[model samples]
Target: MSLNIYHEARSEPQIGQLAVAHVTLNRASQSKQTVEQVVTAPKQFSWTFLQKSYVPKETDIFVDCIQTAMKAMTSKDFTKGATFYHRHDVRPKWAQSKTYVAKYGEHLFYRN
Candidate 1:
Protein backbone atom coordinates (compact mmCIF):
# COMPACT_ATOMS: atom_id res chain seq x y z
CA MET A 1 0.00 0.00 0.00
CA SER A 2 2.84 2.34 0.85
CA LEU A 3 4.59 1.42 -2.35
CA ASN A 4 1.48 2.09 -4.37
CA ILE A 5 0.96 5.47 -2.74
CA TYR A 6 4.64 6.35 -3.14
CA HIS A 7 4.95 5.40 -6.78
CA GLU A 8 1.57 6.73 -7.87
CA ALA A 9 1.41 10.00 -5.97
CA ARG A 10 4.78 10.85 -4.44
CA SER A 11 5.08 13.86 -6.70
CA GLU A 12 1.53 14.88 -5.80
CA PRO A 13 0.44 16.72 -2.70
CA GLN A 14 -0.20 14.95 0.60
CA ILE A 15 -3.94 14.90 -0.11
CA GLY A 16 -3.26 13.18 -3.38
CA GLN A 17 -1.26 10.49 -1.70
CA LEU A 18 -4.05 9.90 0.79
CA ALA A 19 -6.61 9.82 -1.98
CA VAL A 20 -4.73 7.10 -3.82
CA ALA A 21 -4.40 5.09 -0.65
CA HIS A 22 -8.09 5.41 0.02
CA VAL A 23 -8.87 4.17 -3.45
CA THR A 24 -6.84 1.07 -2.77
CA LEU A 25 -8.66 0.54 0.48
CA ASN A 26 -12.03 1.08 -1.13
CA ARG A 27 -11.28 -1.44 -3.85
CA ALA A 28 -10.18 -3.99 -1.31
CA SER A 29 -13.36 -3.52 0.68
CA GLN A 30 -15.62 -3.63 -2.34
CA SER A 31 -13.99 -6.70 -3.83
CA LYS A 32 -13.87 -8.57 -0.56
CA GLN A 33 -10.14 -8.92 -0.91
CA THR A 34 -7.26 -8.08 1.32
CA VAL A 35 -5.28 -4.93 0.60
CA GLU A 36 -2.38 -7.09 -0.54
CA GLN A 37 -4.65 -8.92 -2.95
CA VAL A 38 -6.04 -5.71 -4.37
CA VAL A 39 -2.59 -4.21 -4.75
CA THR A 40 -1.00 -7.28 -6.30
CA ALA A 41 -3.87 -8.12 -8.64
CA PRO A 42 -2.80 -7.87 -12.25
CA LYS A 43 -3.19 -4.47 -13.93
CA GLN A 44 -4.54 -2.79 -10.81
CA PHE A 45 -1.65 -0.48 -10.03
CA SER A 46 0.61 0.47 -12.93
CA TRP A 47 3.77 0.70 -10.87
CA THR A 48 3.46 -2.91 -9.79
CA PHE A 49 4.11 -4.06 -13.36
CA LEU A 50 5.54 -1.05 -15.18
CA GLN A 51 8.54 -0.64 -12.92
CA LYS A 52 11.38 -3.10 -13.15
CA SER A 53 12.17 -2.75 -9.47
CA TYR A 54 9.87 -2.39 -6.50
CA VAL A 55 12.60 -0.97 -4.31
CA PRO A 56 11.90 2.63 -3.38
CA LYS A 57 14.74 4.96 -4.31
CA GLU A 58 13.65 7.98 -2.30
CA THR A 59 13.83 7.10 1.35
CA ASP A 60 12.25 10.26 2.75
CA ILE A 61 9.40 10.20 0.30
CA PHE A 62 8.91 6.51 0.89
CA VAL A 63 8.66 7.14 4.61
CA ASP A 64 6.08 9.81 3.98
CA CYS A 65 4.08 7.36 1.91
CA ILE A 66 4.18 4.86 4.74
CA GLN A 67 2.83 7.45 7.10
CA THR A 68 0.16 8.35 4.59
CA ALA A 69 -0.85 4.73 4.23
CA MET A 70 -1.20 4.44 7.98
CA LYS A 71 -3.32 7.53 8.13
CA ALA A 72 -5.50 6.28 5.29
CA MET A 73 -6.34 3.19 7.27
CA THR A 74 -8.34 5.31 9.70
CA SER A 75 -8.95 8.59 7.95
CA LYS A 76 -12.38 9.50 6.58
CA ASP A 77 -12.04 9.10 2.86
CA PHE A 78 -12.09 12.51 1.28
CA THR A 79 -12.26 10.95 -2.19
CA LYS A 80 -15.99 10.28 -1.80
CA GLY A 81 -15.44 6.53 -2.23
CA ALA A 82 -13.48 6.74 -5.40
CA THR A 83 -12.41 3.32 -6.68
CA PHE A 84 -10.40 4.42 -9.65
CA TYR A 85 -8.00 7.21 -10.58
CA HIS A 86 -5.72 8.32 -13.34
CA ARG A 87 -3.20 11.07 -13.82
CA HIS A 88 -4.53 14.34 -15.15
CA ASP A 89 -2.25 14.26 -18.17
CA VAL A 90 -3.74 11.10 -19.64
CA ARG A 91 -7.17 9.91 -20.65
CA PRO A 92 -7.82 6.25 -20.12
CA LYS A 93 -10.58 4.61 -22.14
CA TRP A 94 -11.98 2.97 -19.04
CA ALA A 95 -12.49 6.34 -17.39
CA GLN A 96 -15.09 7.37 -19.90
CA SER A 97 -17.79 5.34 -18.17
CA LYS A 98 -16.75 5.97 -14.61
CA THR A 99 -18.43 8.45 -12.34
CA TYR A 100 -16.21 11.47 -12.02
CA VAL A 101 -15.20 12.34 -8.51
CA ALA A 102 -12.88 15.03 -7.22
CA LYS A 103 -9.33 15.75 -8.30
CA TYR A 104 -6.57 15.86 -5.78
CA GLY A 105 -3.12 16.92 -6.80
CA GLU A 106 -2.37 15.51 -10.25
CA HIS A 107 -4.86 12.67 -10.34
CA LEU A 108 -8.46 12.60 -11.43
CA PHE A 109 -10.59 10.35 -9.28
CA TYR A 110 -13.61 8.25 -10.23
CA ARG A 111 -16.13 5.76 -8.96
CA ASN A 112 -18.26 3.20 -10.75
Candidate 2:
Protein backbone atom coordinates (compact mmCIF):
# COMPACT_ATOMS: atom_id res chain seq x y z
CA MET A 1 0.00 0.00 0.00
CA SER A 2 1.20 3.50 -0.80
CA LEU A 3 -0.07 7.06 -0.84
CA ASN A 4 0.22 9.61 -3.64
CA ILE A 5 -0.44 13.34 -3.65
CA TYR A 6 -1.06 15.36 -6.81
CA HIS A 7 -1.29 19.10 -7.13
CA GLU A 8 -3.73 20.69 -9.54
CA ALA A 9 -3.32 24.44 -9.90
CA ARG A 10 -6.59 25.56 -11.39
CA SER A 11 -6.43 29.26 -10.63
CA GLU A 12 -4.18 31.76 -8.92
CA PRO A 13 -6.52 32.22 -5.98
CA GLN A 14 -7.21 28.53 -5.69
CA ILE A 15 -4.70 26.01 -4.41
CA GLY A 16 -5.56 22.75 -6.14
CA GLN A 17 -4.23 19.32 -5.35
CA LEU A 18 -5.32 15.78 -4.81
CA ALA A 19 -4.05 13.09 -2.48
CA VAL A 20 -4.67 9.43 -3.18
CA ALA A 21 -3.76 6.04 -1.77
CA HIS A 22 -3.27 2.74 -3.53
CA VAL A 23 -3.52 -0.77 -2.12
CA THR A 24 -2.74 -4.14 -3.65
CA LEU A 25 -3.05 -7.70 -2.43
CA ASN A 26 -1.67 -11.05 -3.50
CA ARG A 27 -2.40 -14.61 -2.33
CA ALA A 28 -1.25 -18.13 -3.05
CA SER A 29 -2.37 -21.53 -1.90
CA GLN A 30 -1.99 -25.28 -2.43
CA SER A 31 -4.67 -27.86 -1.80
CA LYS A 32 -5.01 -31.60 -2.03
CA GLN A 33 -8.06 -33.87 -1.80
CA THR A 34 -8.75 -37.56 -2.03
CA VAL A 35 -11.99 -39.08 -3.34
CA GLU A 36 -12.42 -42.46 -1.67
CA GLN A 37 -15.12 -44.20 0.37
CA VAL A 38 -17.97 -41.74 -0.27
CA VAL A 39 -15.63 -38.91 -1.35
CA THR A 40 -13.77 -36.28 0.65
CA ALA A 41 -13.22 -32.52 0.30
CA PRO A 42 -10.65 -29.95 1.48
CA LYS A 43 -11.02 -26.17 1.51
CA GLN A 44 -9.05 -23.13 2.71
CA PHE A 45 -9.63 -19.40 2.67
CA SER A 46 -7.55 -16.35 3.74
CA TRP A 47 -7.78 -12.61 3.33
CA THR A 48 -6.14 -9.46 4.65
CA PHE A 49 -7.19 -5.85 5.10
CA LEU A 50 -4.77 -2.95 5.35
CA GLN A 51 -5.26 0.75 5.89
CA LYS A 52 -2.86 3.66 5.54
CA SER A 53 -3.10 7.43 5.93
CA TYR A 54 -1.44 10.16 3.89
CA VAL A 55 -0.86 13.81 4.70
CA PRO A 56 0.54 16.80 2.84
CA LYS A 57 3.16 17.60 5.42
CA GLU A 58 5.19 15.72 8.03
CA THR A 59 4.26 18.00 10.92
CA ASP A 60 2.65 16.21 13.81
CA ILE A 61 -0.21 18.67 14.11
CA PHE A 62 -0.91 18.60 10.38
CA VAL A 63 -1.23 14.85 10.28
CA ASP A 64 -3.21 14.78 13.51
CA CYS A 65 -5.65 17.43 12.34
CA ILE A 66 -6.13 15.81 8.95
CA GLN A 67 -6.89 12.46 10.53
CA THR A 68 -9.23 14.12 12.96
CA ALA A 69 -11.08 16.09 10.31
CA MET A 70 -11.27 13.13 7.97
CA LYS A 71 -12.83 11.04 10.71
CA ALA A 72 -15.31 13.80 11.52
CA MET A 73 -15.97 15.06 7.99
CA THR A 74 -19.50 14.47 6.67
CA SER A 75 -20.47 13.27 3.22
CA LYS A 76 -21.47 16.73 2.07
CA ASP A 77 -18.38 18.38 3.48
CA PHE A 78 -16.23 15.82 1.72
CA THR A 79 -18.13 16.02 -1.52
CA LYS A 80 -18.16 19.79 -1.79
CA GLY A 81 -14.85 20.75 -0.19
CA ALA A 82 -13.65 21.54 3.29
CA THR A 83 -10.44 23.17 4.45
CA PHE A 84 -8.69 23.07 7.79
CA TYR A 85 -6.16 25.68 8.83
CA HIS A 86 -3.70 26.00 11.69
CA ARG A 87 -2.30 29.07 13.29
CA HIS A 88 1.28 30.03 12.54
CA ASP A 89 1.91 29.85 16.28
CA VAL A 90 1.40 26.10 16.11
CA ARG A 91 4.61 24.24 16.90
CA PRO A 92 5.74 20.74 17.70
CA LYS A 93 6.35 19.53 21.23
CA TRP A 94 10.10 19.37 20.68
CA ALA A 95 10.29 23.07 19.94
CA GLN A 96 10.83 25.56 22.70
CA SER A 97 7.99 27.93 23.45
CA LYS A 98 8.39 31.40 22.02
CA THR A 99 6.31 34.53 21.83
CA TYR A 100 5.54 35.19 18.17
CA VAL A 101 2.56 36.63 16.39
CA ALA A 102 1.55 35.49 12.94
CA LYS A 103 0.45 37.99 10.35
CA TYR A 104 -3.11 37.94 9.13
CA GLY A 105 -4.09 35.13 6.73
CA GLU A 106 -0.94 33.15 7.29
CA HIS A 107 -2.39 29.67 7.41
CA LEU A 108 -4.86 28.66 4.73
CA PHE A 109 -5.50 26.00 2.10
CA TYR A 110 -8.24 24.34 0.04
CA ARG A 111 -9.29 20.77 0.58
CA ASN A 112 -11.54 18.17 -0.93
Candidate 3:
Protein backbone atom coordinates (compact mmCIF):
# COMPACT_ATOMS: atom_id res chain seq x y z
CA MET A 1 0.00 0.00 0.00
CA SER A 2 2.86 2.33 0.85
CA LEU A 3 4.47 1.44 -2.45
CA ASN A 4 1.28 2.45 -4.23
CA ILE A 5 1.31 5.79 -2.42
CA TYR A 6 5.03 6.25 -3.12
CA HIS A 7 4.61 5.65 -6.83
CA GLU A 8 1.28 7.41 -7.29
CA ALA A 9 1.94 10.32 -4.92
CA ARG A 10 5.55 11.11 -5.81
CA SER A 11 4.44 13.58 -8.47
CA GLU A 12 1.79 15.08 -6.21
CA PRO A 13 2.04 17.30 -3.14
CA GLN A 14 1.98 16.08 0.44
CA ILE A 15 -1.70 16.99 0.64
CA GLY A 16 -2.42 15.16 -2.59
CA GLN A 17 -0.58 12.08 -1.41
CA LEU A 18 -2.32 12.29 1.93
CA ALA A 19 -5.64 12.42 0.13
CA VAL A 20 -4.76 9.45 -2.05
CA ALA A 21 -3.58 7.43 0.91
CA HIS A 22 -6.72 8.17 2.85
CA VAL A 23 -8.94 7.27 -0.08
CA THR A 24 -7.15 3.99 -0.68
CA LEU A 25 -7.48 3.07 2.97
CA ASN A 26 -11.13 4.04 3.00
CA ARG A 27 -11.86 1.90 -0.04
CA ALA A 28 -9.92 -0.98 1.44
CA SER A 29 -12.09 -0.97 4.55
CA GLN A 30 -15.48 -0.10 3.07
CA SER A 31 -15.22 -1.99 -0.23
CA LYS A 32 -14.31 -5.62 -0.65
CA GLN A 33 -11.36 -4.69 -2.86
CA THR A 34 -7.87 -4.93 -1.49
CA VAL A 35 -5.50 -1.97 -1.62
CA GLU A 36 -4.23 -2.94 -5.06
CA GLN A 37 -7.72 -3.56 -6.34
CA VAL A 38 -8.92 -0.19 -5.04
CA VAL A 39 -6.01 1.75 -6.47
CA THR A 40 -5.81 0.05 -9.85
CA ALA A 41 -9.48 -0.32 -10.63
CA PRO A 42 -9.50 0.40 -14.37
CA LYS A 43 -8.59 4.12 -14.92
CA GLN A 44 -8.34 5.25 -11.32
CA PHE A 45 -4.82 6.18 -10.22
CA SER A 46 -2.95 4.87 -13.27
CA TRP A 47 0.62 4.50 -12.17
CA THR A 48 0.25 0.76 -11.85
CA PHE A 49 -1.56 0.52 -15.13
CA LEU A 50 0.97 2.68 -16.94
CA GLN A 51 4.13 1.21 -15.57
CA LYS A 52 3.92 -2.39 -14.61
CA SER A 53 7.69 -2.53 -14.13
CA TYR A 54 7.83 0.22 -11.55
CA VAL A 55 8.74 -0.70 -8.03
CA PRO A 56 9.14 1.61 -5.04
CA LYS A 57 12.34 1.33 -3.05
CA GLU A 58 12.31 1.97 0.68
CA THR A 59 14.00 5.31 1.09
CA ASP A 60 13.83 7.13 4.40
CA ILE A 61 11.80 10.01 2.99
CA PHE A 62 9.42 7.63 1.20
CA VAL A 63 8.87 5.70 4.39
CA ASP A 64 8.40 8.81 6.47
CA CYS A 65 6.06 10.55 4.02
CA ILE A 66 3.84 7.50 3.64
CA GLN A 67 3.82 6.94 7.39
CA THR A 68 2.70 10.51 7.98
CA ALA A 69 0.04 10.22 5.31
CA MET A 70 -1.21 6.93 6.71
CA LYS A 71 -1.26 8.33 10.25
CA ALA A 72 -3.45 11.22 9.10
CA MET A 73 -6.11 8.84 7.72
CA THR A 74 -9.17 8.53 9.96
CA SER A 75 -12.39 6.60 9.37
CA LYS A 76 -14.13 9.95 9.06
CA ASP A 77 -11.85 11.15 6.28
CA PHE A 78 -11.75 10.04 2.66
CA THR A 79 -9.93 12.68 0.68
CA LYS A 80 -12.53 15.21 1.70
CA GLY A 81 -15.18 12.51 1.30
CA ALA A 82 -13.96 11.34 -2.11
CA THR A 83 -13.98 7.66 -2.96
CA PHE A 84 -12.65 8.21 -6.45
CA TYR A 85 -10.02 10.44 -8.04
CA HIS A 86 -8.06 10.98 -11.21
CA ARG A 87 -5.62 13.33 -12.78
CA HIS A 88 -6.97 16.67 -13.94
CA ASP A 89 -5.60 16.14 -17.46
CA VAL A 90 -7.95 13.25 -18.11
CA ARG A 91 -11.75 13.27 -17.79
CA PRO A 92 -13.15 9.79 -17.53
CA LYS A 93 -16.81 9.23 -18.29
CA TRP A 94 -17.28 7.91 -14.77
CA ALA A 95 -16.34 11.26 -13.21
CA GLN A 96 -18.87 13.15 -15.28
CA SER A 97 -21.70 11.84 -13.10
CA LYS A 98 -20.02 11.81 -9.70
CA THR A 99 -20.10 14.88 -7.53
CA TYR A 100 -16.82 16.75 -7.32
CA VAL A 101 -15.47 16.76 -3.80
CA ALA A 102 -12.02 18.34 -3.83
CA LYS A 103 -8.87 19.00 -5.81
CA TYR A 104 -5.37 18.56 -4.54
CA GLY A 105 -2.33 19.16 -6.69
CA GLU A 106 -2.82 17.66 -10.14
CA HIS A 107 -5.65 15.35 -9.12
CA LEU A 108 -9.38 15.91 -8.77
CA PHE A 109 -11.16 13.87 -6.12
CA TYR A 110 -14.83 12.86 -6.40
CA ARG A 111 -17.54 10.94 -4.61
CA ASN A 112 -20.39 8.70 -5.80
Candidate 4:
Protein backbone atom coordinates (compact mmCIF):
# COMPACT_ATOMS: atom_id res chain seq x y z
CA MET A 1 0.00 0.00 0.00
CA SER A 2 2.71 2.46 0.97
CA LEU A 3 4.80 1.41 -1.98
CA ASN A 4 1.95 2.11 -4.31
CA ILE A 5 1.55 5.48 -2.68
CA TYR A 6 5.26 6.27 -2.82
CA HIS A 7 5.51 5.26 -6.43
CA GLU A 8 2.14 6.48 -7.68
CA ALA A 9 1.72 9.80 -5.93
CA ARG A 10 5.10 10.60 -4.48
CA SER A 11 6.09 12.49 -7.57
CA GLU A 12 2.99 14.62 -7.70
CA PRO A 13 2.82 17.93 -5.91
CA GLN A 14 -0.03 18.99 -3.59
CA ILE A 15 1.10 16.55 -0.94
CA GLY A 16 -0.12 13.66 -3.07
CA GLN A 17 1.24 11.27 -0.49
CA LEU A 18 -1.63 12.26 1.77
CA ALA A 19 -4.10 11.35 -0.91
CA VAL A 20 -2.46 7.97 -1.19
CA ALA A 21 -2.66 7.49 2.56
CA HIS A 22 -6.27 8.57 2.56
CA VAL A 23 -7.21 5.93 0.01
CA THR A 24 -6.10 3.15 2.30
CA LEU A 25 -7.64 4.66 5.41
CA ASN A 26 -10.94 5.43 3.72
CA ARG A 27 -11.23 1.94 2.30
CA ALA A 28 -10.65 0.52 5.77
CA SER A 29 -13.41 2.68 7.17
CA GLN A 30 -16.02 1.82 4.57
CA SER A 31 -15.29 -1.87 4.10
CA LYS A 32 -14.19 -2.84 7.60
CA GLN A 33 -11.03 -4.20 6.09
CA THR A 34 -7.80 -3.85 7.99
CA VAL A 35 -5.28 -1.59 6.33
CA GLU A 36 -3.38 -4.63 5.16
CA GLN A 37 -6.41 -6.31 3.61
CA VAL A 38 -7.45 -3.18 1.82
CA VAL A 39 -4.00 -2.84 0.30
CA THR A 40 -3.62 -6.48 -0.66
CA ALA A 41 -7.08 -7.08 -2.07
CA PRO A 42 -6.82 -8.72 -5.47
CA LYS A 43 -5.83 -6.22 -8.15
CA GLN A 44 -6.02 -3.23 -5.83
CA PHE A 45 -2.33 -2.45 -5.95
CA SER A 46 0.55 -3.78 -8.05
CA TRP A 47 2.94 -4.42 -5.16
CA THR A 48 2.05 -6.03 -1.84
CA PHE A 49 3.53 -7.27 1.43
CA LEU A 50 3.47 -10.88 0.24
CA GLN A 51 5.72 -10.69 -2.79
CA LYS A 52 8.76 -12.83 -2.14
CA SER A 53 11.01 -10.46 -4.06
CA TYR A 54 9.89 -7.48 -2.06
CA VAL A 55 12.39 -5.70 0.13
CA PRO A 56 11.59 -3.16 2.77
CA LYS A 57 13.67 -0.06 2.14
CA GLU A 58 13.68 2.69 4.69
CA THR A 59 13.87 5.87 2.68
CA ASP A 60 13.91 8.68 5.18
CA ILE A 61 12.08 11.03 2.86
CA PHE A 62 9.38 8.55 1.92
CA VAL A 63 8.83 7.65 5.54
CA ASP A 64 8.69 11.28 6.47
CA CYS A 65 6.18 12.08 3.78
CA ILE A 66 3.91 9.20 4.66
CA GLN A 67 4.19 10.07 8.33
CA THR A 68 3.16 13.64 7.64
CA ALA A 69 0.23 12.50 5.59
CA MET A 70 -0.94 10.10 8.25
CA LYS A 71 -0.73 12.82 10.85
CA ALA A 72 -2.77 15.16 8.71
CA MET A 73 -5.51 12.57 8.40
CA THR A 74 -6.05 12.03 12.11
CA SER A 75 -8.25 15.13 12.49
CA LYS A 76 -9.91 15.15 9.09
CA ASP A 77 -9.99 12.78 6.16
CA PHE A 78 -8.91 13.86 2.74
CA THR A 79 -9.04 12.15 -0.69
CA LYS A 80 -12.59 13.30 -1.36
CA GLY A 81 -13.74 9.83 -0.34
CA ALA A 82 -11.44 8.16 -2.79
CA THR A 83 -11.18 4.45 -2.08
CA PHE A 84 -9.60 3.63 -5.43
CA TYR A 85 -7.02 5.11 -7.77
CA HIS A 86 -5.21 4.18 -10.94
CA ARG A 87 -2.33 5.52 -12.92
CA HIS A 88 -3.36 8.40 -15.13
CA ASP A 89 -1.67 6.80 -18.11
CA VAL A 90 -4.00 3.81 -18.10
CA ARG A 91 -7.73 3.32 -17.81
CA PRO A 92 -8.75 0.03 -16.27
CA LYS A 93 -12.19 -1.56 -16.72
CA TRP A 94 -12.87 -1.41 -12.98
CA ALA A 95 -12.83 2.36 -13.20
CA GLN A 96 -15.77 2.46 -15.57
CA SER A 97 -18.21 1.94 -12.73
CA LYS A 98 -16.62 3.99 -9.97
CA THR A 99 -17.17 7.61 -9.14
CA TYR A 100 -14.22 9.82 -10.15
CA VAL A 101 -12.75 11.62 -7.15
CA ALA A 102 -9.55 13.47 -8.09
CA LYS A 103 -6.12 13.08 -9.57
CA TYR A 104 -3.13 13.63 -7.34
CA GLY A 105 -0.10 13.16 -9.53
CA GLU A 106 0.02 10.31 -11.97
CA HIS A 107 -2.95 8.69 -10.20
CA LEU A 108 -6.61 9.29 -10.77
CA PHE A 109 -8.63 8.41 -7.68
CA TYR A 110 -12.11 6.88 -7.56
CA ARG A 111 -14.73 5.41 -5.22
CA ASN A 112 -18.08 3.62 -5.22
Specify the poorest-scoring 10-residue window by lDDT in model 2.
Answer: 20-29
Which of candidates 1 and 2 reaches a greater TM-score?
1
Every model: Cα RMSD to truth: 0.8, 21.1, 2.7, 2.7
Scored by CA lDDT, what does every candidate get?
0.93, 0.22, 0.74, 0.72
**Model 1, span 6-79: residue lDDT tens:** 88899998999999999999999999999999998999899888864688999999999999999999889889
**Higher-lDDT candidate of 2 and 4:** 4
lDDT of 3 by residue, 1-112 (tens): 6776777776677788888787787777778788778777786667776875455565875776667566755434746667778889987889989989999889898877
Candidates ranked by TM-score = 1, 4, 3, 2
lDDT of 2 by residue, 33-65 (tens): 221111111211011112223333446534443
Q: What is residue 71's positional error in candidate 1, in angstroms?
A: 0.7
TM-score of each: 0.97, 0.16, 0.76, 0.77
Candidate 1's TM-score: 0.97
Q: Which of the predicted structures, 1 or 3, would earn the higher lDDT when compared with the native?
A: 1
TM-score leader: 1
Ranking by lDDT: 1, 3, 4, 2
The digit string of per-residue lDDT tens for model 4 on 4-111 reads 565546566645677778888888889998877887788666665345333336586567656655675674666778888887889799999999988777788898
Q: Candidate 3 versus the native: TM-score?
A: 0.76
Instruction: Judging by lDDT, tell me the better candidate of 1 and 4.
Output: 1
Alpha carbon deviation, residue 109, candidate 1 (Å): 0.2
Model 2 CA RMSD to the hidden true structure, in angstroms? 21.1
